[model samples]
Target: MQRSAAISLTCLISTAVLIKSSPPEVGFTLANSVQIMALSPGDPNSYSRPDLAVVTHTNLKLSVDFDAKILRGWATLYVKKCGITDELILDHKGLNISSILNDADDTALQYVLGEAVEYGEKLSIKLPQSESSNNTYKIRIHYETSPNASALQWLQPEQTAGGDYPFLFSQCQAIHARSMVPCQDTPSVKSTYSAEIKAPANLTVLMSALREEVIESDGATNTYKFNQPVPIPIYLLAIAVGKLESRQVGPRTHVWAEAEFIEQSAYEFAETETMLKTAEDICGPYVWGIYDLLILPPSFPFGGMENPCLTFVTPTVLAGDRSLAGVVAHEISHSWTGNLVTNANFEHFWLNEGFTMFVERKIDGRMFGDKFRDFSAIAGLNSLKEAIATIGENNQLTNLVPSLIGVNPDDAFSVVPYEKGHTFLYYIEHLLGGPQVFEPFLKSYLDKFKYKSIVTSTWKEYLYEYFHDKVEVLNTIDWETWLYKPGMPPAIPAYDNALIETCKHLTKQWLQWDENTSCPFNKSDITNLTSNQRIEFLDELLLADEILSQKKLETLNEKYDFDTIKNCEIRFRWLRLCLKGRWRAKVTPALTFVTELGRMKYVRPIFRDVYAWEEVRQQAIDTFLANKDKMMYVSAYTVAKDLHLDING
Candidate 1:
């Protein structure tokens, strides 16, 4: 039941298309698979992709009304079960399976559903009673689809960031695909799938998995039939349907984007072939075929998502010419780590994200040289730190071993998985000296565990069993200090002094939430920072803590006041920072800034989207005027409704 979930840096969690029925009537403790062991079957696969999935979807038809956000479909699935079992457990999260027909007759003897869990556009139904002991069974399912609830939604009529065409999109990494469809939505339940979607003919549909065929024309609607044979976890399944265009670079290499953004996506992804080829060279081969990209309608939220062959990237990558090669490299490397070998559960999500992130640096260095690669690492660390702080909890390096699937599933997953995972791998690589030594070990690990479920312990065991001489390398490094601790480790010479300074400054500003102060600025050294530096300071100030003091906040706002008419990024940052710094105070200065920002119409969506900005601003003002005596300080206890917005309050 997965629509499409990729491990993004902000949400570093693996996803599955699982079917839950009747709330734990039947739960799979662990899903195990067996592969022919040429040598260490328990070690890992030698980088060969799973090549045997024979489920075919045909005559696949779908109808979607964007306004309603609902999808209805009927399809014929031909399954040559091989040895998979008689009753095949297909993923069907969120969708109601109206009927199941075998051949041309209704042969579904009976179906057993475990617990039904709703998430995004997917729904998971655990079927404990579908006869599958037999070698094969012909089956078909009728279903309806809808928009994923977890998606970052926007008013439909709104234009893209560039103000061209209106569009909508979703991010499905971690375990949110249950909101999209229902099925055995776990990585261990790998299967082949095909899809045919009906969409507005004017719009283009981009998908992540493989596409053996497609049929399109300028009519009332278009039919996209994708024939995929690769055995992939449900999370990698994806589709992006909207008015768009594409350009082909080479055999199996293409770029997609809205007409208005065609040039940008093409330009930014120009080096895609090189990146894909480089990754294949290092990781063995491209199992899912060639690489393609989709530059979605604005509001993609994250940089990129590695969905099998198609990597979905935000339009923001088009900002600074074609300098987005780093992101492309990261997503492409996922073809090996995240896409090929995946994490078994959300808690071990770092297995997918961290490995991909680390391999990205290696690929970038090989393709774009060392300087660009180094920058990518620094950026990864910065972004990871920001994600950890948002949760307002300690980010211990050792905690990466805990399972996310059992711990509320919601709070258990985080950027720490990817960020910390990558950091750990980077440390491992550093300990191993260079790629010459590490590449074989990585290849050997993949060779052993491909198509199998893995966790931190599995990885540790493999490391010890294969490289016993270097096993002490793990002991030397303090994994606990990194994963279980609240802050980053001390500076290593691997990064430049500038990067270290950036981490220190950002970390200090972020930790300020625990260390409150009247004025959060480092007034002593504000003069020498660059424009980017100043913006970073302001961003952290707003995000780190709640606005509590009315008078002191107003005075601080005045102290950092800037010319109201300027278009400087700093001006935008100042308005946003002040509003966040004093929303609790609900003072005149904060209210005035909110009104001015609205009137100026120059606010970034990130700020304007602040939870109930309009309502909260007015409420603060009314509350202050009405109850100035008894309640002097604005309350930081945000009702649950307000948490939906960026602000926790």
Candidate 2:
């Protein structure tokens, strides 16, 4: 679940330490004397009572209705009663439940739908007395999702690349899963799932699982069956149906996209196998069997969603040069950090994002070099600063483990967790020995907590236990400031500036250029720079004390031809610079970029910059109003907040 907006800002640092002997391989079992608690202390955002009874498995039978833009079907949940409770609780939003049947006997079950709250409505169903001797029970819920399900983004034919068939995709991370399924919508509870989805015969259907078989029910529709043997949080439960085609990219990988972008996607993600192998070398064996990629439409919000076997990626990454493929590495690393070892709740989100960022850079370093890894970390640090400034330095949301009670996790999403978490891990790596010492601990940690959800405290305790010999050095770290403090990190690691120095020098030259001085820059000045280096140079300019003048920007575009660049990352930074300088010519280009793709990372900031310019504020609002219906729920919701526009209107 890597956010595309923060992809460019990812950072990493590595070091080495001396050890007395080889670190012993730890087993999956925890010590009985440690008194481990439940997966979480009850997620505040969920209404489910996992403490009493929890769903262990979910079997879905749903039919897609593109005309009505809804999914009507039944979910049969296999539950395990943990306490002497007479009811089963689940989380649901905008779903109409028709009936609840006790699968043991063909009898109806009484249920209550609680009032809607900030998160969602609480669904409580009276449990039928079990006739079996075991504690497990099966309850079937027949329901239909609303046309406006926040988790689903229903696209018309015009919104898709092919413009021949409609598309449907789901984004259920954080808490939106409840809108689509009747289950405990929290990462603390994981369940194995199998789905039978019926959609138009012409459209292809895919989920976050291995495809068993597809049956042609009739000439009009087909039933796509998928089975996920691995138990995963409901958030990882994904489904997409559209005019899709697949091309075999690797032994266990396939790149799925529309006919228009299929070839480009296959080429862009050709290194997915290399990334998976590199991640395995750094972390551990890949638990999920297959690692396929689904190149989603431009309206896909995030950079990538690590949905178990199938990773959902934004079309913005098809930069033709494959320079942006590192995002796949981030999602691949999540196979262990996030999907394998889950975050107990959104408060401990850093455990998922920060660890993934650390591992992603490890893959980068292994694939490229240590210097490139450090350069990425430096870029991440700049992004962290920008995030803190955007979300006020003193705001508690900037904390690594901020209290998410009553706060929408969507609103709290930022680079703090991704970059700050990576910074903390890197700091610890430097303090202890380097990768030689810490990398072993990472594998051990994954082995200890794989397939389980945990909090920050559990991770910290394990960290202390792993490096018992370095407890004295660990004691020197200020846990309070690092975990709870809001602003910049307490200390920045000594990153190798050998690579970024060139970007800095170029940035300085551009900042110092003026009408009094002859144009000192040319296209050759940047010809040797990598795509990431050019991005770093642009990032530095954005953070400068004063925005570059329009004349200088014109010179930049003329010299570098940034206006014609196909790379989204470079285009994003260039547009922001132009908008900040109040270059009216780029305003239409910026608007087109925002409307064409719904990646929040690029859209939100550009919209904010446009809104800041009084002359275009109304124009920005109008453009958003016209396109809000096409944007993903999270993207539209957050962008509306940035524009101060009423979403209902």
For each candidate in turn, the TM-score is 0.67, 0.93
Off by over 4 Å in 2: 1-41
- In model 1, the Cα lDDT at residue 65 comes to 63
Please report, in order, the local distance difference test score of every candidate based on alpha carbons: 0.52, 0.87
Writing each residue's lDDT as its tens digit, candidate 1 over 194-283 gives 777777776655566566555665577777777555656656766677666789865768887767778767776777788777776678
Clashing pairs in 2: 4-303, 9-380, 11-377, 12-377, 15-434, 16-433, 16-434, 17-433, 17-434
Clashes of each: 75, 9
Which window of 10 residues has the lowest lDDT sum in candidate 1? 630-639
lDDT of 2 at 639: 93
RMSD of each: 10.4, 8.4
Report the C-alpha lDDT of model 2 over 1-649, residue by residue, as the tens digit: 2211111111100000011111212342454112112112356567777767778778999999999999999999887666678998888898989999998787999999987755778899998875644567889999999999999999999999999899999999989999998888887776688999999999999999999999999899999999987778889999999999999999989999999999999999999999999988988898788999999989999999999999999999999999999999999999999998888778789999999999999999999999999999999999999989989999988999886655689999988999999999999999998999999999999998777777787799999999999999999999999998788889899999899999999999888777567887889999999999999999999998888888999999999999999999999999999998899999999999999999999999999999999998998999999999999999999999899877865
| TM-score top scorer | 2
